[model samples]
Target: MEESTNIDQCTMEQKEPRKVTKRKFRYIGDFQVSDLECPKKRRLYWNPTQKFMSSSRRKYVTLKTKIHRLKNRINYLSTLLTELTECDRKFPVPRSIDFNKQFVTVELIQGQFVPDLMNLIIRFADSSK
Candidate 1:
């Protein structure tokens, strides 16, 4: 009975092929697109990384250019401010004026000094006439 039981177990083991579980392989170093052969799979893996790198580089250059332009603008504005300050200091505006005029004729005084209100009244009367 024991011999027959051993024979039965051996036959059963042979009939059921050993269910071998394969361990999925992992990559060690980075593999390039061409290494991954099939075109679609290669594109899926590589394109996004390349695209991101390109866009980021472009953005970096643009930012650098803008910074340079802003620096130049600041320098120009500073120069303009200095010039304006110098002008203000050099020439201040004059506000009030006082004046007197004299005239002489060959035998008499050509003009007379008249009071301010009288001059205005005379001018008004002449205009009304």
Candidate 2:
């Protein structure tokens, strides 16, 4: 389970396709991470959104392997949310952010995400652009 191991040990965080693909996706094209073009390789078994992410509770995940899945899932949701919301400077800005990194440092917010706040983020992102 190298994929699982990579998620935990890797310094950066991002979502991974459930299956592998030989096609290479560039950083800034139709298949770019920002575009978040859905993978055509594997049928998307789950459409777990940020709302679902908030509900995810993986207790008893003592093994590093167990935690990897949870962390990677969250990172993917964070990226998607950022894209959908069109966040401005609100997006994570990890000091060493690179293509090889596994995790992004998204701003940590406590409590439920207010719809109003989401709207605000959208407006902010729009204005910045």
lDDT of 1 by residue, 10-66 (tens): 998889777899533233234564657977656565665676678899999999999
Task: State each model's C-alpha RMSD to the native.
Answer: 24.6, 31.7
lDDT of model 1, residue 101: 26
Query: Who wins the TM-score comparison?
Result: 1
lDDT of 1: 0.67
Runs of candidate 1 with Cα error greater than 4 angstroms are 1-43, 88-129
Across 1-129, the per-residue lDDT of candidate 2 in tens digits comes to: 989888777745555557866654322222334334555522221233332444453333445666798899999988887685667667664445464332222222432445656888999999998
Q: Which ten residues in a row have the lowest lDDT in candidate 2?
A: 99-108
What's the TM-score of every candidate structure? Answer: 0.35, 0.20
lDDT of 2: 0.54
Highest-scoring model, lDDT: 1
- Tell how far residue 55 is off in model 1, in angstroms: 0.6
